[model samples]
Target: MSYLRISDTVVETYRIVHYEQTNFLNRLHGGDMLFFLVETGMLSATKVAKGTSLLASLDDVVFKKPVKLGDIIRVRAETVYIGNTSLEVEINAFNQNEEVVSAYATYVKVDDLLRPVPVGVKIVEENEEEKRKIEEIKKRRESKLSKIADRQKMRFRTEDITEGIRYKISNVIHVSPELTYDGKIMSAGKLLKLMDDIGGVVCFNYIGYNNSTDYTSGAVVTVAVKGLTFYSPIRLNDIITIRAGLIYVGNTSADVIINVIREDMKGLKEHVATAYFTYVRIDKEGKPIKMPKYIPVTDREKNLYEEALLRRGLRK
Candidate 1:
């Protein structure tokens, strides 16, 4: 079996410039972009791994650029290294101008049951079809993110206000599922799961880690729901955008800002929910690890921690 073959997977594309994707600055939110990138990476890896990995863990990521509406966004995934039981994959996101918006990610290999398989077991029987798929993914990588490039595109309802006070990233990041909420949104454990997903996305998509790695996610050292706000009740069909961005990096923990936005404006542009979370980075044994600098927010993100703590403290 050939040890390596370049591949390409065009996961998703959109001209969507909905307010739900922007933050208080009215620009595309970082947290939501992270979520989308990670989810897409997982899908691509599953296709290559034949559904053997359960997305065991993620490391870290840095956002190099921003993506806006009318900029055809494209995501590509490819295998860089593969082990008997895990694989290292790199993911890249591009804007219409073909500039890299984000990079890097890693994925672990799982077995037929979606559980982590043994650390060193062959996962796939290579074939020509797999090679072709890899090539297709590569073709996209060499091309521009927006094929329509310089062509003029339709401006949206909020196009004129790119500099306006933006909608906080609630809509892009923290999407309450269309299903009921028996406190799933507020559950500390559930919130931790969201944190994992967030980190996984960063490491796998932005930092170029692959799904076939051997590392596993650790435990939570700190999970503070800094603050949460609701404009109106969120219901079905409203795209739940769960967005997150880095706040502070410690030797072993990092703070993240998360938000969930729905069409709850009641037909207006009102933010629905927001949160500030601090998670401890840990190893497979669940021990805290150090993290360096990461992506930062562009809007007013000052002393929001103390504010979130106050809100989380006052029980309803």
Candidate 2:
């Protein structure tokens, strides 16, 4: 327990030997499989937080490849940074062939009422590699982030105020038609891989973090995938974009809206999937973490937002 830090856990290094982890295409389901990746990260956070960490916020997550039912899956998690009360964890799930299949988020610590709480976290001594990792994180947070909260709220905010930034998740799928059993071009699992990869990039890769972090590392807080959806067949060379914006911030978590759009196709640009996932901010032990007070919404964000709160309810 004392060996854990804000960003260092890789619990999911197993194979998807059963059909349960896959989809109709004999591959992992985008939403279900991603959740499994998240579970590994969450457990790590909970362990490092001394069981005090709770999921507080979740940002962009995407799937990159289709994990066949028998393929090996590897999940890794690490703490990005730790504040007085909150921390961030980045989760990455890969396939047996060393290909990343999905991305996920766990949270910081929280209280019994689901409120952010600052709990004691055991920090291990930092090494040269640790120093480099932390510096890279600082640079990314400083450069890319538009000033999200060190602590977040629960509940998707109806207002748009992401500090002039919109979260984006995208995927580039170049699958062969031969892989399809029937005339179907692609399977839902493959689509999920694309989304997870894109979302992972938006969440971590773009900044710099990749591969996997150590077991002791941790993030400010962790987030989870509430749900997922897929649109028409995604063929080879399709450039897809997934954008997430602030919806609402509850006392314990932040609600975000995700939008998926395919650029390769012409004609209709339907909304592929939108979901609501809740995460608790906690320490390494799974205790809850406190969230920020408030973040002001912007008029532009609101205007660009889809205001699909009503449609979200129908996603069950």
Candidate 3:
């Protein structure tokens, strides 16, 4: 097998946070940051894989600091590990010198037919530092795999929403050409932005803001995202069904779970991706405000509530 140096797979890009990329509070949107990270990660992976790379899973994404408008954000991504058919990328975004966002994403190398293919190249460590970093990456991957196995055993159906403050909404959108990178499969970054948009809508609806006239009530801003996994790829012209539901609420924060389902022309539907987004309610001054508490009335609600609590604890 051929070997490629880790430096050969490094990709870096910079962009100024535009006005359109900011939220209502004039801060960089979390989803936009995710888009940039995924884009950079894919570029780095493709350099080593020698073909298309599809995002398979992302985890441990934490927003450390809020990026303001006009701030120049620099993102750096590099392939840290090479598996048989998959690779892991570590991406970091910084404002000047301080790190603001960090994420690890796994991508599967795919051929023209979109089938997983073995990566023909392996990463060559240049020094002890690179070797140590790869070891850490392996450890993290193993831990994540164990957690996924445990979560699968739980098998809690997220579609079951019964009473209480479980505000839910569904939106449909046609996957346009602009959303795809290879003119066929949709870009994961665009799908993430759509998910975050629907998630914010669900949070606002739960807090009693249903229309434009309710703007004076309050605003919701995303703080963090946890365990975003893409089980299948979305294709071009596919009808995407995005479902968002309020799962748990705290003093000033709430957890919204968004599920994306794709339907082809022939009417076959598949669950594409699912993630838990944490948002905080803020007033006109952008200060945290008290949100209405959520009470679990059904078994499903309780289960989801407990799971959210677990995720929250893990975040801490």
Candidate 4:
């Protein structure tokens, strides 16, 4: 129904960081940056798809500089690759003319049932630069997949989830109109907010209510989001079920995996998204405290635990 090219779909947006977007330290919250990245990238994808698109996966992100409140953040998003039903976008954010954050993500065009559909679009490379950029992105995507495969093959040890002191929380909520775009599709920014909030709650409850006497005695702060992948789109007023559970616990840090599910007309549950968030437990004085040891039991838990360790190693 729509014919478009990447050259015409490249997106650029800007926002001024405000107090609501900053943390206690007056620095832009990692979650806020992530949400903005996805939001800006999705616009380019939608432009190319000529309609709604569902976010599939977010690539590894690196923040090079701290973004301060009142800074003007400019985000540029470009489509790097196009598949039968998907688009991969590379987005970068700059503050005060300096690059601060870089990320890439993939999204798919879908139908009412959330099944992949053809993106009615075409690409017209305008010049040699555009051609080279496409080639570069292709190689980068291939290199990233190769690294993931190599890491999996090298991993050996496994920790079971059942053996650990864990916590699980689930909530069902209706998506409000304000959280949606185009009067129907839920925005990726809202989904990120849900994940961050739920992940923090799971970590806090596991550390405070589950392990300590007074839940109000301490607090939990998100240090990073390991990864997040979306499988389907959530529509306005959709009944969504979000669940979070403890996956790994370190000396002063913990990892939680959150899943988003939606109920169909037949009452069947369908998974829409999954994300991993890392949190650090802090005392009233904002100092990290030692956490209880987590033991893994099941095979899946063991694999996740080992992978978490690997990711933590890479992060450090």
Q: For every model shown, what is its TM-score relative to the native structure?
A: 0.40, 0.46, 0.90, 0.73
Poorly placed runs, candidate 4 (over 4 Å): 1-8, 111-115, 120-136, 139-165, 206-227, 250-253, 280-301, 310-316
Which candidate leads in lDDT? Answer: 3
Which of 3 and 4 is ahead in lDDT? Answer: 3
Worst 10 residues of 4 by lDDT: 153-162
- Which 10-residue window of candidate 3 scores lowest in summed lDDT? 153-162
lDDT of 1: 0.44
Q: On lDDT, who's better, 1 or 4? A: 4
Clashing pairs in 4: 159-302, 160-296, 160-297
Q: Write the per-residue lDDT of candidate 4 for residues 25-86, one digit (tens) a residue.
A: 46677678888889999899988887778777786666667788899999999887787898
List the global CA lDDT of all models. Answer: 0.44, 0.47, 0.85, 0.74
Order of the predicted models by TM-score, top scorer first? 3, 4, 2, 1
**Reference-based lDDT, residue 224, model 3:** 82
- Give the C-alpha miss distance for residue 27 in model 1, angstroms: 1.3
Model 2 stretches astray by more than 4 angstroms: 1-10, 13-17, 60-62, 102-106, 122-125, 139-316
* lDDT (10s digit) by residue, model 3, range 58-94: 8778778889899999999999999999899999999
Model 1, 1-316: lDDT tens digits are 3333434323444445567665323445454555555565666565566654433223234445555544456766555445555554455667765744444444556553434554442223267776564455345433422432422231112121112212222224334552423322222223334544564343333222344445433333332333232223334344445566554444565555655444433543333344455555545444456554443344443344344335445323
Worst 10 residues of 2 by lDDT: 150-159
- The RMSD of every model to the true structure, in order and in angstroms, is 19.4, 18.6, 3.1, 6.3
In candidate 1, how many Å is residue 148 off?
Answer: 44
